[model samples]
Target: MFSFIIRRVLLVIPTFLAIAFLTFVAIRLVPGDPVEARTGERGISPERLAHFRHELGLDQPVWKQFLDYLWQIAHGDFGTSISTQTPILTEFTTLFPATLELAICAMLFATILGIPAGVIAATRRGTFVDYTLMGAALTGFSMPIFWWGLLLILFFSVDLGWTPVSGRIDLLYYFEPVTGFMLIDSWLSGQEGAFSSAVSHLILPTIVLGTIPLATIARMTRSAMLEILGEDYVRTARAKGLSPFRVVGIHALRNALIPVVTVIGLQVGALMAGAVLTEYIFSWPGIGSWLIESIQRRDYPVLQGGILLVSGIVIVINILVDLLYGVLNPRIRHAR
Candidate 1:
């Protein structure tokens, strides 16, 4: 198990470098100059433009710039944002808690409901319950994040007025964010209706963000459970006069979870990607919105560093998931 973990951790170095290089090059390839973006509408003199370029090191060759970038990253400097002048790491830490909170809520929403839904669908394979649940999952998986988010806002916010149209919490409740997570901070504030307001604000965004993950997890769980149910051990458990719940839940579900957990881990990337659209639509103050603003302004440092950090997080999570595989199924560690 230790060796398996070490190998996975070792693999992250090359993967991180590849991601950093690709993100550096790809953002640069996009049309628009950061200097031009900064001096929008008013424009600048040729000498001024040259000075800005030189100051930003854009006057250097691409290879040199990349090497400098690598060196800066190696020294734990993500560089100041060309547009905001704020350190990328500082901005990310400030905003990331909001994204983390939203992502956690969305994943919890998906996992809490999706696992049971999948279990029921698999257990009643040929029944109407299976068909209905699977159909719903398919529909959810196929829905576009932007469209779904809008429809939800229109219905819940506009027509019914059941939820806030956008933002993390009500503007009426102003308090220092000790944790940066609105739900927890609001509760800690001890103001009337603060926590409830936070929850209300989160509802539509969470549902929209969680929909795809929920569908994917449900389908994967169902598939794994179905396969596990037919395994010899499951049948043996049943033959040994164990209860149906123990046969399926204890025996089949445990093995089924190996693949389900993998799918769940893979969903982190999807959730982050989806958060961009979800945050835009809902106006959530998270990393997704921050990245979008940076892109619009052609903030190269923020774009490159933000993407690199996000990718690093995803890579770390996936490595943790791989380690979890050894815990969930001892055979995986033994095989390694």
Candidate 2:
């Protein structure tokens, strides 16, 4: 596992360069110039624009700028945001953890709910229980995460007064921004007030982001479970007087989880991608919301840095999932 992880890490270096190179070229290919975007109409004159260009190294050749940026990245600098003039790495580092927390929570909710729901549907095939679970999963799949978030807020918060509308905590509670995750800090500090507010605030967004993954997991789980249940081992288990519950849960569920894990991993990557909309809706201080603002302002450094960061995360998670496949299913390991 250690050697495998090291190999994956080594591979990501070239992957990063390739993604960065393509992204840099693609963004620059867009019609508007960042310099003009900065100056705006009736703004700075040509001389000032020229000075700004020199200051930002925009006067340099494109390849030179790209190579310079890569060099800086190698040295742990992500450059300053074009609009804000703040270090892109600092800004992103502060914001990303919040999004990470939200994504992790959503993934957990999806796994906790989706897999079991799928298994239930599979085990109870052709029954009302099966239909109801699958029906719910289908509906969940159809709903967009942002739309789902708004509906949840409207119904649960406004109409029902069940949960908070936005943000990560009650304004009244006012938990310190330790670790950028209110729920985590609340638990870490053992403060009931903070914990309650954090959990309550997380309710709507978590459910919203969790819905699609739940649907995907449920469908995969059902399919995998059905296939596993039909395997001869399952038949033999039943023939050996194993209870239906054990036959399905113990005998089939673990094996079925291999593919389900992959689905969940891909879902996690999607959740991070979707988080931009989710954070914007919820007014959460996360990378997605920040990235959107950067793009809107043509903040080149921030945009590129954020995209690379997300790409790296998605890539890492996928590699982790691949390694887990070997760990879970010994056939692959033995074949190796």
Candidate 3:
């Protein structure tokens, strides 16, 4: 297990490098110059323009610029944003964790809701429960995240008055900055009231963002559970007089988790990818919204940095999920 984990962790480096390189190249190929885009129609004088290019290192050869960028990246410098004039890494820190939390909450919500719903649906196969759960899952799986977010806003925010439609925290509740995340900081500061408010604000977006992934997990879990329940081992366990709960929960469910874990991991990645829409809808300040702003402004450095961070996060999560397979099914890992 240790050896396998080591291997998986080691593999993340090159994979991230490849993603970073691809993102950098792709951003460069886009048809607008960050400087020119920001400078607008009043063309600057030749010397001033040259100075700007040199400042940004655009005056250097393409290959040299790439290598220089690589060197800077190695030293933890992500370049200054043309639009914001802030270090790319600096902006990323402010934005990344918000999205990370949102994605995590959404993922957890999905799995918690999806898995149990799936288990019940599978256990009660061909029943009304199955039909009802499947129908809900189908709607969730088919609906778009953006569309879901708007619906949630309309229903929960406007009509029901159950939750706030957008933002990460209630402006009425002030929180001290301890960890940069409002909920955590609020808790650490012993302000449960603020924390509760923050959580309330998060509920709608979390559900809206999570619905699709939840559906995915439920569908996968149901399918996998059904397949496992019909296997010889399941019958053997039942024949041995094990209680139905023990047979299903302890034996079949444990083994069925391998594929479900895979689906959940993929859904996690999907949630992170889907957050751009979620963030926009909620007006949540996060990397996804930053990416959108970068694209609109042609802030290549910001765009590349954000893309690399997300790709790296997704890759790392996938690697962790791959490692989970060994833990879930030792037979697969120990197989000759």
Candidate 4:
């Protein structure tokens, strides 16, 4: 297990490098002049434009610029954002936790609801319960996030006035950002109603972001449980007069979880991608919204660095999930 972990950790370096290089090259290929983005088309002088490019090292050959970027990255510099003029790392540290908080909430919502729904559907098999549940999952999986988020806002925020329209919390509450997570920070603040406010604001976006993951999880769980339920061991357990709930929940569900865990782990990447749309619709101040702004302003460093970091996180989580297989099924560990 130690050797396996070490191998995965080592692989992360090359994977990170490959993602970074691809992002760097891909951003340049997008037809937009960062200088022009910074300075309008009408007013900027030729000499000023040239100076700006030179200062940003855009005047250098592409290979030279790429090499300099690599060297800077090696020294732990993501470089400054051309538009914001802030260190990419600093911006990341500030904004990333917001995304993380949202993602965690979204995943929790998915898992809490999804797993049981799947189990119920599987157990019911050919009944209306199964059909209805599977139908809902398909709908959730097929719907676009932005549309779903907007519809939720219109219903809950606009018509019903049940939740805040946007933002992580109402601006009326003042709390020092200790962890950059609103829910925790609200509790830490001791400000009355702050935690509740954060939760209310979180509901719409969480539902929007989690819908796909929930649906996917439900489907995968249902499929896995169905297969496990038919196994010889399941039949034996049933014949042994074990309670149906115990037989299914303890034995069948546990065995079925390997694939379900894999699906859940893979959904992290999807959640991040979906967060982009969800954040935009809800106007949430997270890395997703920040990345959108960076793209508009043509901030190359933030674009490349942010994508690299998020991808790196996804890769790490996937590695952890693979390791978890050994814990879930000891045979995997012994085989390795």
Q: What is residue 154's positional error in candidate 1, in angstroms? A: 0.7
User: Between the candidate structures 1 and 2, which one is better when assessed by lDDT?
Assistant: 1
Question: What are the per-residue Cα lDDT tens digits for candidate 1 across 1-336?
Answer: 677678878888898899889988987888877999878889899999999899989999999999999999999999998877899999999999999999999999999999989999999998999999999999999999999999998998999999999999988999998999999999999999999999999999999999999999999999999999989999999999999999988999999999999999999999999998899999999999999999888898898899988888888888888888888998877787
- Can you tell me which runs of candidate 3 are displaced by over 4 Å? 41-47
User: How many times do residue backbones clash in model 1?
Assistant: 0
Give candidate 1's error at residue 122 in angstroms.
0.7
> TM-scores, in order shown?
0.97, 0.93, 0.91, 0.98
lDDT of each: 0.92, 0.86, 0.84, 0.92
TM-score-superior candidate, 1 or 3? 1
Clash pairs, model 4 backbone: none
RMSD of 4: 1.1
Q: Which candidate has the top score in lDDT?
A: 1
Reference-based lDDT, residue 258, model 2 = 90
Over 1-336, each residue of candidate 4 has an lDDT whose tens digit, in order, gives 788889989988888888878888888888866998877667688899899889888899988888898888889988888877889999999999989999999999999999999999999999999999999999999999988888898999999999999999988899679999999999999999999999999999999999999999999999999999999999999999999999999999999999999999999999999988889999999999999988888888899889987897899889988989778988898998
Model 2 alpha-carbon drift over 4 Å, by segment: 1-3, 31-35, 38-42, 189-192
Better of 2 and 4 by lDDT: 4
Q: Ten residues in a row with the worst lDDT in model 3?
A: 173-182
